[model samples]
Target: MLVVKQALPCETVDFPLSSETQRFINICLGVPVGQGYGLTETCAGAAFSEWDDISVGRVGPPLPCCYVKLISWEEGGYRISDSPMPRGEVVIGGHSITKGYFNNEAKTNEVYKVDERGIRWFYTGDIGQFHPDGCVEIIDRKKDIVKLQHGEYVSLGKVESALQTSNYVDNIMVYADPFHSYCVALVVPPHQALEKWAQNSGISYKDIEELCHNDQAIKEVQQSLSKAAKAARLEKFEIPAKIILLPEPWTPESGLVTAALKLKREQLKAKFKDDLNKLYQ
Candidate 1:
């Protein structure tokens, strides 16, 4: 009999995982599981999945000690009161949340403001939905949700998540040109995997650079892209119509990645604008 303890919300991005995963934990632990949503600015935990609201969908309602609100993001065309389950940027207020930046008053004031109700709200930059059932569901990061030319929303984060799971992909960055109709991506293939694939396919390459440019390699990558898209259940418009495989890996030293190895979206976009243009051509 395999025993288990608590389900750490940090363990999964869309926490609580699938229904099967949740059931397995419940059977083993004799205790229910839930997800948590919070940021560094709000200490550790500000919202938790209530036992009843412990579905795979939400991180549940706000904590007892915290007050959370969703404010309309005018630019994103999101308004809280306009829809049944309107999406908006998450703003938090409570004793547990941070007061402000220590000395950077300008930086702090930009995000933290006193609303009409006299409550100081810390803009979280995370987009979310408040359910009729009292659950708070994360939609996406406010900046990551890109609206396409036809007014379709392409979630860049969701696109990246889907592509990164492919065996041929080591990393990926999905980009949406607001002026364009479709999406594009920069894919970083694992060199070792690429080498093995080339060998099995009787293809030759002088180096990773040559391999990335080769037709066969590109074909294999496209196949992987299709597979991943299907797995992630993405719509056609949300998927990248074309991709640019990078021979060189993005690094913190190059300022393409953060110290934590996460993509610096703005920097990558600036550096690869020319390459992305080619994808459209």
Candidate 2:
């Protein structure tokens, strides 16, 4: 079998690509694959990684079509005065900005703003870190951040993204209750990876559902989750102490995710009420 190696410039839009996945793609394709950041409100053109940038994670500097700025989000623990770099809510302003929603002035007033200089700005509600190299990394979403019982702020989306990089995790949802000091996870393990692991660990199971219930399997999954969290440099409390493994994956058909494949968190919470209770217990 002859496999021809090909190199082409690639760019990912819409979703924020994980650092691990970006690096993997770069290596496998023998080309630098850049990730771009934008919102529908901004006409889908904001920041984009340079094709020559071999580094991973950042979405590069703001495009000339728009101006980017960071506003302090104290509640989410991201401030513009952060030591190593400035981190805050990313705001996009300039020509590429949307005018307003159709027939909804109230909704428009909430996120759309006009500065003293007559520049239009859109509050993206996305937390970002600006690097010295002029690149920006979208780290978390304001709506997805929660306060733990200890008053520590944790970004559920951030934690889930980090954990999803684990080989064992096919999908994951991080749950945090204000009544609890730590977070937990509902994970869907990859079938092939989980089966191979179970076999290596001398565990027996008729199917994925049976393997999900195995004590040793659960322990191994937890370890993998921890390893991924540590690798992503998540804080101590950010790590999920307990996890509930689910055999099924979350898809749009399951009502757990949107048509775009984004998680419908409220739906997940409602559907996994019992599993969540068990994890907390």
Candidate 3:
């Protein structure tokens, strides 16, 4: 039996594997894949993928005895209201759905609304759609889609995914700045691995700061960024023309990363506002 887990968009290399180990696996072993999805509001195991390439970012069709729908909203946003649709929020209502929030009726009322039909539905914050082939493709999180200068929608996840494919990158956070033409990235490298590589290649550097400021090292990082952009299939506008190498990793103590290690994008942007301004200037 074989099991594979797709790398996260923010993860540059096989995190569980060492740099040398990853190279060996990629050269000798085949690809790896796996699937699982759940919502904090939903109990767990709401949807998942059993087959390969069913659809990217989909939680497969609803499980047996589960009900899913794409409900239309009177307001601007569309929602997975009740099923049979190509797009909308992913709402689930069935035995698996949670009844309501604890001691927070108002919060519960906002998501678990009762329709005229008297049926209960849990409004999943994720936006997605069901495919013709019976798969679900998560388009974007309700909050992750940013309108570009041209009014086109860009998925931050897509751009971040591209950046993560770079061999030199450890993790990255990509976000749009209202004042810039393109996006920007706060890049974190696998310092230990990169230092080893640098040493092995006879590229001496005093420290990470020196490496980041080194013209040749910057060029190598840029090349990795280009490769990531290509792998992610990003539009020209979506690519970050500028990247800032962070001096340190984002952590909960720094209030830059979430408990789950996800970037606190808004906070990161605000924290690096001056650096970003310098780039634009």
The prediction achieving the highest TM-score against the true structure is 2
lDDT of 2 by residue, 1-281 (tens): 53537778888886777777889878875778998999999999799989899889889899999999999998888999998999999999998999989999999999999999999999999999999989998888999999999899999998998898899988899999989999999999999999999888888889899999998999999999999999999999999999989999888889998887788999999999999999888
Off by over 4 Å in 2: 1-4, 102-106, 200-202
Q: Model 2 compared with the native: what TM-score?
A: 0.88
Tens digits of per-residue lDDT, candidate 1, 107-186, equal: 89888887687777788998888988778888778778888899988888768877777898888999888889999889
- Candidate that would win on lDDT: 2
Q: How do all models score by TM-score?
A: 0.80, 0.88, 0.72
Whole-model lDDT values for every prediction: 0.81, 0.91, 0.66
The window of 10 residues in a row where model 3 has the poorest summed lDDT is 8-17
**Tens digit per residue, CA lDDT, model 3, 1-281:** 54546542221211122334434444444433323455666677566655443223445666675667765542325555435556777787776768888999998988996668766678876677777766665555766767766565667876776678787778788777655567777788888866766787789888887776666666677678877687667788887777777658778899988776777878987898898776666
Provide backbone clash counts, one per model: 0, 0, 13
Score candidate 1 by lDDT.
0.81
What are the clashing pairs of model 1?
A: none
> In terms of TM-score, which candidate is stronger, 1 or 3?
1
The Cα error of candidate 3 at residue 50, in Å, is 4.4
